[model samples]
Target: MKKIILGSLFLCASTAYADRVDNVQTEGVLSSQITMTVADITCHINQGLGISQQIHIPTISTNDLRTGNTKSVEVPLMVDCQASNDQPGSIAIHLVPAGVSTVSGDHTITTSLDSVGLELAWKDTSLPALIIGNTEFTPAQATNNVWDLSLIARPVLLAGKNVTEGNYNASLAIKVTYY
Candidate 1:
């Protein structure tokens, strides 16, 4: 009988200990997402023109001691930065004749730009003239992205008793760069 009581007590203690034992549990959940997009770049020429009158020197004679005449030709070139990513910091433009990639003439000419207000002359004997200008996008500085540059090419007809009678044909080209 004593053994039976001891066994019963031991069993009760074991059962109590088992009940006190706790079942621990842990869990975690993680999630994430990502996305992206891209686009292509492009450029185009909006408008360009020569803002000077086409001169017609009918006849030049030897007795005429006066020098050649000068005409102001304004080459107005416009570029639309609306299509560009941002406003261009600066721009450079070069003018070349249609057939000739370089300037070759008899007389020296002076040219400049009114926007940036810069002037330069041709030092070389082969080239006719060199012109430069500065432009800004601001309304106060420059109204539009467009730059209107003026160049002066003085045509000095050779002084002699008998000069040729024919049409003197010449061409001009303008190149632009944006940064």
Candidate 2:
């Protein structure tokens, strides 16, 4: 009887150990893919200037619109670029409206105020007016991989539309591509 009891206890212990082993998970796989962008040049907005820039346009009067004179503010944008080698990379920048476009017939971008819009151009007038979302302005390198791109913004009234007086706001995005 003693021998039989001892043998049964051993059998029960073996069964419990087998069940524990079966419940254990033994295998798994983890995977990840890495991708890199290869470019000869990289450009960034100057740290001090930051990515967002605000141009303050002084108040405009209806009489001012009747005449050709309007207040224009200078927007100075500084960009820093680095080339992988001695050869400088080509950089092109374009402006895009951040929100819905209200482009008027005169090629001016409409602001929040009705009939009121803005016109953008390079400070160096020889470069020509910057057509919103259409023209890419190529900036000359003022120094070693540094660009002092200056632009001008002015408020104008559309023809036949009455101006609404209130605060007006508009946003523009500067997109840069390097090759």
Candidate 3:
């Protein structure tokens, strides 16, 4: 019967499985511990990036002055980080440029002012500057596993363009990760 043929096939297959492993040898003792530890990473921000910031620009009348206009904005990225063994760990940050999320390798936002170019550069104020978006980089953990982060942003107009008179805006995202 068809039923008998199927049962014979199943029996043969199970017998073959045992024969396949006949030459296996027992290895040395294998052991490990699934240890658990506690770590604390905290971030504090009084205001989110959604809030529109009103920046005061003196004036934009002179062509020479407007072409060389540079503004600096200092912000705080207050954070507390603690890794295993109570030591500083490797950390990386990815800042999503204004008006982008799904795209990869995003950079600074394009200024709203017509026929004008704008660029932004940001870095940590510490001795060794950690310029965001420059290259693939990770920084050693701050002392005491805590960081009072002070970030500076420099927004400047790209050369060789006639400056325009208007207020421009941009928004960016900050993402921090540790390893």
Give each prediction's root-mean-square deviation over alpha carbons: 29.0, 19.1, 12.6
Model 3 stretches astray by more than 4 angstroms? 1-40, 43-69, 82-88, 100-108, 115-118, 122-143
Which numbered prediction scores highest in TM-score against the true structure? Answer: 2
For model 1, residues 16-108, the per-residue Cα lDDT tens digits are: 778555663346676777674343323345342332335333343423313333332333344544455555555555554443222333222
Show model 1 residue runs off by greater than 4 Å.
1-66, 79-85, 100-102, 105-141, 158-163
The CA lDDT of each predicted structure is 0.39, 0.67, 0.48
Ranking of all candidate structures by their TM-score, best first: 2, 3, 1
Report model 3's TM-score to 2 decimal places.
Answer: 0.49
Tell me which of candidates 1 and 2 scores higher on TM-score: 2
Q: lDDT tens digits, residues 1-179, model 3? A: 87999999999998888876757765778799898767654433322342234443334544644645555555555445443344335555565555521222133344455433334333453332232443233334355555544445444444555656676554556665645
TM-score of each: 0.39, 0.63, 0.49
Better-scoring candidate (lDDT), 1 or 2: 2
Show model 2 residue runs off by greater than 4 Å: 1-40, 82-88, 105-107, 132-141
Error of 3 at 31 (Å): 12
Global fold similarity of model 2 (TM-score): 0.63
* Sort order, lDDT high to low: 2, 3, 1
Better of 1 and 3 by lDDT: 3
- Provide the lDDT at 127 for model 3: 35
